[model samples]
Target: MLCVTDRMKLIHTKGTQGIRGHTILFVVIGLLITETSTQAANSTDEELLNLKLRLNTWKNRYRVLCNKYSELAANSSAPVINCTGCPDGWFQVGDQCFLLTRDVRVDWQASKKKCAEIGSHLAILTSKEQHEALENERMRTRVAYTDFWIGLTDVENEGDWKWVDNSMLKTPFWNTLKSEPDNNQSGGEEGEDCAVVDSKSQSWYDVPCSFLYHRVCQMDAIPLQ
Candidate 1:
């Protein structure tokens, strides 16, 4: 599989004008090698044909996915992606790709910017199922105790919470034990505006946006057609 950068380079290179023919030639060579190996293993011709057909079908699907990605990248600030599924570090969960930042701990605003730099937004979970899926992935991490900054915030209006997409919070999984979104302003000059999901408690809490914490970035994962 080609890396995102390599795919972008191939698409832009003038010398790659005959990429279609080159790609077809490579596929044919690969198929021939497979056919030879299958024959050596005493495989039937019909089985070989079926395998080739499956490969061809997948190849066509890959091309279509690549073309769609190119169009999206060209039209917007989306990251240049050639293949489908999640990126290298991202985990897939029900058509969405999520990345839990492990090494870096930054303020909520900085975390949001970092996610945007990679062509993804802060994690905006809409349903309990999605949230649970992400939480399960988070639990699998070595540093499962650390809290993660989500896309939720009450920046504009103090009590009116909204996700990164500007959608109002509907089905909140707030930690009632903590009495969260209490907008605690004991030590800080600003009120608690950003939301963070506590890994230990398994619930959300509103904290000062300036507080340093790990972040979760999310984006749509292209489905294999």
Candidate 2:
């Protein structure tokens, strides 16, 4: 019933309306995506801020505790070295702190005395784990085939080894390869009375107490409250 030109105009109008509807739908979807991204970014910023605040709070608390400990230590006669953990330059293993000194080499007796002066004792390797820790530390120093004195000696009675702590040696972890503790008395030595740990093999060997070597020191870790 309509003329050709009118029919064409009606078709064009419908097409325009359809295109406008699609544009509106796309704009709505884009706005939703942008809003969601903004919200997520805001949430992430809040979480990061909270984490930073907590870290700062903990650091402040640690500083206060350190100051308190220092004051207490100054007043006490036998100053309790209650570290929050191991003191600086000391490594913590289990409940013990260990320090290996590579600079100063001294005889067994002198080494033991030095440790006492520092409120520690020559290292006592009571277990394989303790031995391993010392071994690992030695490796870290990159000192190859070096000997380090431990807190073991049979000076009181030959063949009756004991720890400096006065504990009788139970199960020995000696390196039998070179027939160690042979008491070889080589080079006119009296006897091999003191024990030294070999860096390479991580094994124990007895050398003359007068022999100079590096030393390892051990102390009890600070108790946690």
TM-score of each: 0.60, 0.61
Per-residue lDDT for 151 in model 2? Answer: 96
Q: How far is candidate 1 from the true structure (C-alpha RMSD, Å)?
A: 21.3
How many clashes (backbone N, Cα, C below 3 Å) per candidate? 0, 0
Please provide, for model 2 over 47-139, each residue's C-alpha lDDT reduced to its tens digit, 9 standing for 90 to 100: 999999997798678867866887787888755554445777788787799988867688999999999999999988878888788778767
Question: What lDDT does model 1 reach?
Answer: 0.83
lDDT of 1 at 114: 95
- Local accuracy by lDDT, each model: 0.83, 0.84
- Rate residue 115 of model 1 by lDDT: 95
196 Cα displacement, candidate 2 (Å): 0.3
Candidate 1 ranges with C-alpha deviation above 4 Å? 1-84
Which pairs, if any, clash in model 1? none
